[model samples]
Target: MKENIDLFTNLLEKKYGVWNRNKALFGTTPYGKVASDLSISSSQFSKLLYGTATEGMYERTLNNINRLIERQSIEKAYEETQLVINKSKTAYRKRIYFFSILFLGIGLITSYLFDFNHFAFKLSDYEKHPLKSYFYPESSMFFDSPFIYNNAISENCPCSGFEGKWKLSESFKLPLPGMKKPGLYYQAKSADMIIRCSNLFDSYIDKGHGMMGYEHLKSEIWIDTKQEPLVPQYFNPSSKVFTESFKQLNFESDPRFKKIADLAAFNVNMFKIHGDSITRNAELTGRLAIDVNKKLAKKYNIDIGYIVKNVLGDLIKASCKTTFNPFCNPNDLSEGISKISFDCVYTINEENLGLNEGYPYTKSYLFKDQVFSDYLPCECEDN
Candidate 1:
């Protein structure tokens, strides 16, 4: 643990350079911002550095630090590899140009001597191999350069800025507890847009579908930020963002929607506390559980307790897939859980919330429901 802590400190120094506590609190420093991203407090981060933190905190912090280290290593390696490839490509182009001129001169001499002008001059008419296949191909060949073969990325790549904005649907406050000043802010947005657009561009440029010209493919290159913001439905409490996204459609009238949003906010507030906070979550869940039940019960004027219980129960079961136990003990939220306990639960809760608002189950659509279906794909999968 001490070794890992030292490594983490070294990494911080190398990545962010040295920070001065006299100038700023550790929590307010760029180095401290990393801890904030992991939902660790300044004191806890201090404890982590000094090897005085709990075993769980140590392990979690070490894992995140290791992740940071690994990511940086990969990025550095990629930049180096690209540099080499670019150099090789320049050399290769020069060689190809020299050889092409030599071949053309030889052909012209042979044509003049043998009266084969028809064949030699007609070299310009030789059909060119498709650019996609000649340069970058779906599958690599023996003579292909490292650049061509390396086109496929093992992990998702970020999209170019020209594509459009991919924003998070929900915004959250930082998880730092008891700070005198306002804490950092965060949001949950899609991180895989780059890879998605890359694949799309490959399809377009490669003429994967045999499209004729750029006019037909112009619209496909850009994503409409207003119509489709590419916000994912997953929950990530530690994420911090400096920018804001544009407005999106909201179904604030729905009780379930409000409940899910509130629960998400509550979970973000409770992230990394790992103690009595579970009780607070339980209390919040209890209220939400009752609120949702009451709305359903009053709307249908029938006994919906059993249905609501089963639905939330199923949600809890699904959310606990990574845990030792399959359910959150109402009496003790901290009993057996790992990671953010209530994130996935509320993320999916809004899907069933539409029932309270008089729509069929989320998968299906009713008349004039295209608006909901179009705007919110999470609740309506068919859209």
Candidate 2:
């Protein structure tokens, strides 16, 4: 695929000079003009160059691209191709859904369209507002340093040379297209700060994997800044109160961490109680011509659950990051602070466990068995 891409691009460049995506778009300087031809702003366009773009593309659109480019690479042909590219980019831009920023009116970045759907707060004003930065990047900065990480995920951390930044390539579940990175290891300090800080990390409990049942599968803890003093009175869970009470998260307090522990305990109990039901009803509401025997599928699914649970338990060796966004956000989430989210699958050796291979095999088989989707296969076979 990359070869074909290079070939097509080389052909265009041969006809025209080095093809400038920015010049072809708005016919202006490279700085802001890159975003003008399409819905992706200048920053996003740059990130695309940075190889941090998402892997969402349409085959129809890709096919249409061939017809749109200049055949001869002549000046007039280039103009025509440019117009076609502009239209194509704009068409693709409409499909994405960005998370909304908290301060909508405050213009933070270069383009309005790019920053429109981001969850951003002023780096300076963050003490006043709370953010769930663990799930997604903030509008301005990421909390780093003095992070209290569970011992399960923080062994021999930061690896070797990767100290300056927390979010490194080593932690990525799936590496992005750009440069390779070394992981940054964060350590928690017993300092003047409290459990929660003026710095905030996002809190979102993602539901179970396909047919895995609805429970929080991931628990992420992103460092914000120096912790604020722990205040027990602010235990309320409102949005505004979320900000004020953010300081209540205490690292030393065993009871304080119980909220997270409860989530873990709940997941374990659900697995025990509904283990059969989850595997049994993986494919639900599908009417079949004949009754499909799900005994084997149920067995495979149960085995797969163990694989996942064990893998989740193996966070000790994997990089302690929850998500991997290499470059800064369109709205600049880093606020100049190096950002990295810390998380763990917990207690397993990656070399010993072929969970890498086991994961894909288990996940795929379940889907084929209709364990993750709404459709049911008519025939069930023994593998």
Candidate 3:
């Protein structure tokens, strides 16, 4: 392909010089003039250059080129090619000088209008109106220290490097391309704020994976006294609220996550309730796929199990779009219940979860799986 293109280009340069991709100084492109002479469309001539022309066009163009080469002697062709080369070099030098002057003039004017040290646009303004920096670069020097992070941590947070310059929560309101809305709206001095701003390491408090040593607040708190381990133990499920609520969570009807949920429920309950009795534990663990305490399965129905699975597995899968490491243990289940109730999945921004809008997970196998299909919508129909 390269050889074919090169042969065509070398021949073209010998006859008509380089094909100016931009406008020709006269009227039409050199390629266009040659294409017209050969009775082929400019596009067809281009295709021939890249060896992408149809068989008929390729043959016709080759025949025309052979005749064209034969019409002129090698010495004449060489002399004509030298003239075109000299002209092309002059034009190229003129373009370089023109651009250099244009850029220099623009830079000097920008510096004069808006001092480099004191830009008309503050980082705070850029934080609030992010696009202003790009559109009006003269005003907003967004690359500066404070403005470097378009979306920094909350102003209320002590760890927020920018001292009271910007609010992390405010980023949700801005209509930036890849910016995602926060899961929980943070209010100053509020429980949500305290919960969000307590983190010193990362910008936001991520679900399941928070920085070590930080007392990252969970949505639900464990019951002070342990009751029936099989029963739903977490109290105050509605303590945390999300900016957007989760909908269309078909846990029971969805077989994949349901099976995982049921197994998780059985495992947690069996571990907690029958851990003391080795014989009972082994028997119950074996029957994980089948059932767990038929009397309890019937009594409470699948509600407890569904809740267990929804929080630990379904919600986790939905929120962590990139990675799907679900927790099914009692502690994680309690946190999961909180996540489900507060709609935590939507509260955390997509950026916080390491999601790139340009490269989405909609087509990924994890997204296609029936378990997550309801949570993460796919671009194509499921197989």
Candidate 4:
């Protein structure tokens, strides 16, 4: 039991990252710090510091110390093990749920398009055969040969190095059309996609090789394109309170940080506005579909000229309007505005519009018709 207590005490010191010392002889500095922090007395600390062999003292103090250490170790181990188990279980459940939903969605789509007899025949044939059924009518297109739909799928090509797919390759040659020069271009894909590397000895170091290696390749196209600022409004910097707040944030926070918090809040508001606009447009489009009258147009503010003028972009002209009917059809609404860029109209001035001193102007754009219709009640009016 004496040997066991000594071994246990040694183990406790080693496990807890603490020092092993004689309780009575040790200076008050270390023992006093521990006792003060732990709310234990000198004698109590001494028992843990140098365990005893007597049954009563050993059971009461020494055993309790061992039990406490053991409990901590066990609890830590249990938490770590439980975390791993929970993560694995969650992943397994997600995979099962995903595949089940995918299969179910495919089944529903198949059932909707094909008759029962054809569907059952195809299913049975598919179950029995692999390669032959792979090229079947309905299943062949998206499920069997997804590459047909997604043409970008190719052999382990050079582009993968830049895009982060291939890691072993030292460098990649971009196949830019009509480029006089071709070589590895080191840049980040976007501002949001910068790579960071820390000391290899650090626990937080992520050393996985691949796109992670080429994460430094950032995209600065927005800088050159000179795209209209998303939020061009100037925020009013006139208020003493606001100026102080701005100073506090700018000085204390990270230097690289942009004033994105306000931009994010503005974006959220824009999204809400856009969502409301879409709902109103859908209602207007439905009304137009049934009756294309002047009253309906007036009520919904459906200016045919505006729609025609808005859809004049090169991409929009090439895609939706060219192939689809009614040049500006209602059914083609989904595909038409999928990629339209709406210029944001509002501005935030940190200072009074007249005083441009401390106030910085932010430029923003919203997709036209994406925000609440021009007819909706203005929230600013309420204010």
Considering every candidate listed, which one attains the maximal lDDT?
1
Cα lDDT tens digits for candidate 3, 27-121: 23466678876667878877887689665455345435543543455457889998876777777979978999999999899889986435523
Residue-level lDDT of model 4, residues 116-201, one tens digit each, is: 75754443232221222332335434564311122331221111111211111111111111111211111111111111111221
Most accurate candidate by TM-score: 1
State in Å the error of residue 48, model 3.
2.0
lDDT of each: 0.31, 0.25, 0.30, 0.27
Which of the predicted structures, 1 or 4, would earn the higher lDDT when compared with the native?
A: 1
Task: Output the lDDT of residue 54, model 2.
Answer: 48
* lDDT rank order: 1, 3, 4, 2
- lDDT for 227 (candidate 4): 18
Error of 4 at 358 (Å): 72
Question: In candidate 1, what are the lDDT values of residues 1-383, reduced to their tens digit?
Answer: 77756665665564456745566433345646867765568898888777787776665554455345445765799999988877787779799889999999998888677754455334323322223243335666564532202233212111110111111223322111111221111122111110012232231122111111100000000111122212222212234211232223222332222121111111101111111221111111221221222442343333334433443333222221112221122112121121222332222233543222111111100111010111111110110
Worst 10 residues of 1 by lDDT: 212-221
TM-score for every candidate vs. truth?
0.25, 0.16, 0.18, 0.19
Candidate 3 whole-model C-alpha lDDT, 0 to 1: 0.30
Clashes of 1: 2
Clashes of each: 2, 19, 6, 40
Q: Is candidate 3 or candidate 4 better by TM-score?
A: 4
What is candidate 2's CA lDDT for residue 178? Answer: 12
Give the lDDT of residue 323 in candidate 4. Answer: 14
